[model samples]
Target: MGANLILVANDEVASDPLQQKLMKATAESSGAEIRFFSLEKTIQIIGRAADRQKIFIVVKTPKDVKVLVDGGVPIDEINVGNMHFAPGKKELTKKVYVDQSDKDDLHYLKTKGINVYIQDVPGDHKTEINF
Candidate 1:
């Protein structure tokens, strides 16, 4: 088996510290590579409308992990095999975050032979997807 990859997602401000901490920890413990990607940045990169919601894919690999930290999108729960993630939105934003409950999408990922893991961080930590 290969080394695991961990993806982290969060609000830009709130998630930065935790992502750094997690990166350090992962580097020290698992020798994992961490890649930071912003959902907001992805939106800008993809040239999508900010008002329309987009589902960003954060994948973890043996070499690195992809992260999506967007202030606009609210993510509540994510699942990956034995691991599961649950988190709420910022109190000030009043966003109704929803769980990633799309099995067909997951099934497609499975069909594509991808490995994924999911995690949620509380107020102090940022939630992110892994693959």
Candidate 2:
């Protein structure tokens, strides 16, 4: 595949050695070429090359997707992975939890014509984040 793996995060996340290591490990395990970018930089770079590059964006939260979209990044699809379910948050799936904020952000993304899928693994059947 000619796709590139782009991990999007803020400065705090990009500065963490453990986070960087984990992302690198995951990328290597998946045989993807990985690059890190802050939210703003992600918008800038993806805005420039989204049409030409098969870029997979890994974001920390749904809010990040909203930020990118609000900033004019052309996001046609998004995958919400690693959503750790905890008590009190409504369990959407074994690996996904949602509160009001998550629901709101997801709704916003859907209304903007972005397809959002939530799963630790692709193709797992469950409730979809459809509008």
Candidate 3:
């Protein structure tokens, strides 16, 4: 079977037609079967053995990553992409910016043995927004 790519996000992303359209386009290009879920549903699915092997999850925020980790999701690594820079956020890399809380969360994940990387997508390096 093909791998499953799960995208978990908040209501803002769920309600945005453009975001939805873009997600679908990315999924199509990736050749993986893609699914969208609310954080609640994602938490439920992540613990299932049958669903774990072929799943790659994409979450919007560091808070969301913490939620998944707290829910006992077996995430060994995470790729963070499309992050937007805001005032008061420190630049972690060319594509990543973090506030104190975000840094804390990333540290927590690292302590829990999860590898986190800045995902490099085409055109992402060209923009300050990183979106």
| Model 3 superposed RMSD (Cα) | 5.4
Cand. 1 TM to true fold: 0.32
Q: Between 1 and 3, whose lDDT is larger? A: 3
Candidates sorted by TM-score, best first: 2, 3, 1
TM-score on alpha carbons, each prediction: 0.32, 0.82, 0.77
Residue runs of model 2 more than 4 Å from their true location after superposition: 50-52
On a 0 to 100 scale, what is the lDDT of residue 94 in model 2? 68
Per-residue lDDT of candidate 2, residues 1-131 (tens digit): 35665554565666677888787887887666777778888777765675556777767788888998998877888777677776667877667787788889999999988778865555565356753
Candidate 3 per-residue C-alpha lDDT over 13-129 given as tens digits, one digit per residue, 9 for 90 to 100: 756777877888878877776666777777776666374558767778888889888877678877776667899987767668788888788778878878776648544433222
Pairs of colliding residues, candidate 1:
9-128, 60-131, 117-130
Clashing pairs in 2: none
Model 3 ranges with Cα > 4 A deviation: 1-3, 9-11, 15-18, 49-53, 119-131
- 2 or 3: which has the higher lDDT? 2
Clashing pairs in 3: none
